[model samples]
Target: MFRCARAFSTSPLFKYAAMTCRQYSFQVFRDVPPLRQMRRQLLLDRKTVGFVPTMGALHEGHLSLIRQAATENTDVFVSIFVNPTQFGVNEDLSSYPRTWDSDVAKLEELNDEFARLGGDTGRISAILAPTPKVMYPTLPPSSEVDGDGSFVTITPLSRKLEGASRPVFFRGVATVCMKLFNIVQADRAYFGQKDVQQTVVIKRLVQDFYINTDIVIGDTVREHDGLAMSSRNVYLGARRRAVGLVIYDALKAAENAYNSGKLARSEILDAANGVASRVLSEQQALSPSERALYEVDYISLADPDTLDEVETIDPSKGAIISGAVKMVPLEESKPGEDCGLGDGKVPVRLIDNLIFKPRP
Candidate 1:
């Protein structure tokens, strides 16, 4: 960590350049206390900090957040921790991707890009990648937490949409985020818009608790075919990636309907589900055993604040239009369903959404 000798500099750029004019060297802290001490030092030095938290398996989606943080803050801090509290009994906690080396390499590449730009602010300030023992010190070493420890759970919102299926999700998210926000004490924190409910939950956590950090939502980064980039996208074999496109298509369709003056909730949601049904139906033409099984888990039109399903569009206060799709290979399909030779041998859950505020 470099100290800012000229803390009273008039120009922030000059101050950043004065502080860091050498080759970029970022630190990765494995524990909380030391990281907290460093954060304190950054504040004392008056350096602006932007944070991005992830569960590793970095992708362009994550990089976009990091990139934005680098551009906006004097120093960028990133945390990569795979919290076990979020996973369920049958979830893939054990098999979830943990590309630590690759993640770091990607960060280094981002740093190089920042260097190429010749800007001192874009360098990644540091990384906080802690172990389970570090995050849950009181608990024993295990893949799943005991749930006996303290956690942050926002009611009704946590029980809706994705929460309806994965109950422990928002609790884990809120808890870990609170801990990180406290430790980093960053000026701002960044999150992707892909997880619409998640962004709402985090916003609530920050506001209710009066956390000092500002929450910045980055735009969702998608693939060439419009698939919203996600670390879990790795689960889909090369051939089956298109099967997941239905969610985004549905969301865009819903957004289009809302923009077209279709204000009724049914009209908006029907537009979305209508698109999804057609996509799934076309896939159905494939023999049950030949392609992946697709099911629309939920198509929701809800209050941006409460997450309660809404009956109509509110143009002044935009609505959150979202959907989830369950994609499983026919071979791995449950006992009742006939099996098929499909692209995804494992079950992959896809969620995507867009806000519905029509243009004037």
Candidate 2:
């Protein structure tokens, strides 16, 4: 039982990240003009730059991406903008954990980590903490756009998976990423593999739009107990956290099935769904207010490239098995409050994925 007790809990590898962390000096660019100016300078100087774009709340998963960005680029730039265009009116964009100062502190700590490792260029050079006013300057920050300003949407692709749930997600992601990629114009940008769909979308965005930056994807970092690290994990209060392990367990079941040579999609999905079904069974045994309201959204087996749902595993070309479980905490349940991601409550959505590979 990997029963983690608190929020933001992580492995010992990050023992001193947010705690005992030294604040290193870095540029905090808040507007477009200055950030663009700095970027132009970087390009003129022919210095290799790496970009790591993020929403505020910093965690180990985020840091690992920055670490990779540092190792490859002469300068690294991070953006911490909680994009309003990304969230629907009913979503928890307002309550979506914004630890700004702490986030900067984490970046400082990361820069210092690189400094200790005997490298100067590995440190983050600046951050674009733009405001809603600054980011959405003229365009309205509403997902329900009336097609006024230019918006990016990769049809069909943006309409599936996470997009199917929040139709505006990938549009917002593409729009913001394109905007940031324009602003920073870093030689390469870093992203984590955990947000698999987003990674696919961004890669397509760059390819289709002819964006200059290279998209570098680092492996997903996990907690000591194996849950993929996420900013939203904080919402999984102690009790729900334990049950949340079921999300990963389900993915593991699918992984095990595939590795065991059950290459049929039905076999793999059945194995995964069987593990996830425990949530419903467990719900019957718990009190209403104490339960982690896990309403199964989807357990998917799809092509890694087009994301088209697969019926059978293609050994020559692998597939990605992913799942999403909407978890709402009854203890803090607000019947009317919604995060847009889940039911009409501040739901703690759990999503995870694992790769299936056969040994040679």
Candidate 3:
């Protein structure tokens, strides 16, 4: 009898063990199915993707866009391609920073936080990482025909300021960005306001081509000293760094004049020029190298939307006073030193914008 009891309790213990194992297995299976189903659903749903295309030495300006993208869309994709096509033969394409690994790491960290927030788990599915060839496929024999025949070429607006100088600059930017849009199929894209001209061009391109992606312009990031944050700032030495302030100081002078009721476009330009001239004159005593490596390219008050030069300030309409400055190399500097184009000196373009609202 005892033996029978032992068999029932011990030898038959396999049955009890099996029951417990089944329960544990069922729990494990239950946990997995939900998770798998959730993941599957996530994969199936069409996620709203956001894109921020940059030349990659990531900064707060870029991060601001990423954060904005995270808040607005289910997925955020960043492209770090430093497109060669966009840069003119004489431009700083080679010197442009290419901090790819750092950029990816930053994005990954943002993505992790985004995922934890129950924001899209797929918030940043892929970097849309591609080589220039992949992004800009093979073109036809003629340089005119871009790699893809269906390529978009945005012009007309390309005839202004920066465009006037860097002829093919916008085309390069437009093409690559469009290619990125095609690859990622982002529902929305972000850009910095600092590139006012670029912003204008991208907006026009999307509208003209009927590209479906929505473009968002983030505010320009600036240094505490008021210098606009740019990757090229790294080239500035200590003296040049201090001189850089002249750009903002000049803009502020214009702003002060406007605030003090200097409504005439000429007066505003004069104010800006005055400030810049005074600062430049003082720096001139220092060696040529000590002078701010920037020279007035042009200063004009213009219609904000159309970007056409305006004769006077119309309080009813907003206007922008924008221009570029070329850094002049010291004596012994080559012939092209003063101009941003063709070799002598690198240019640091400075633009300042303000709005004059009509008195109520």
Better of 1 and 3 by TM-score: 1
Once fitted onto the true fold, the runs of candidate 3 whose alpha carbons sit more than 4 angstroms away are: 1-44, 112-122, 140-151, 288-290, 329-360
My TM-score estimates for the predictions, one after another, are 0.87, 0.87, 0.76
lDDT per residue as tens, model 3, 164-275 = 7777777788877777765556778999877777888899888877888999999878888877777666555444556777767777787777778777878988998998
The worst-scoring run of ten residues by lDDT in candidate 1 lies at 8-17
**Model 1, position 147: C-alpha lDDT score:** 49
TM-score of model number 1: 0.87
Model 2 C-alpha lDDT per residue in residues 49-103, reported as the tens digit of each score: 8999998788999999999998998788998877877776677776687676578
Cα lDDT over the full model 3: 0.63
Rank by lDDT (best first): 1, 2, 3
For candidate 2, list the clashing residue pairs, or say none. none
lDDT per residue, candidate 1, 187-226, as tens digits? 9999999999999999999999999999999999999988
lDDT value, residue 166 of candidate 1: 86
Error of 2 at 358 (Å): 7.0
Most accurate candidate by lDDT:
1
The alpha-carbon deviation from the true structure for residue 267 of candidate 1, after best TM-score superposition, in angstroms, is: 0.9
The full ranking of all candidates by TM-score, starting with the best, is: 1, 2, 3
Of the two candidates 2 and 3, the one with more favorable lDDT, higher being better, is: 2
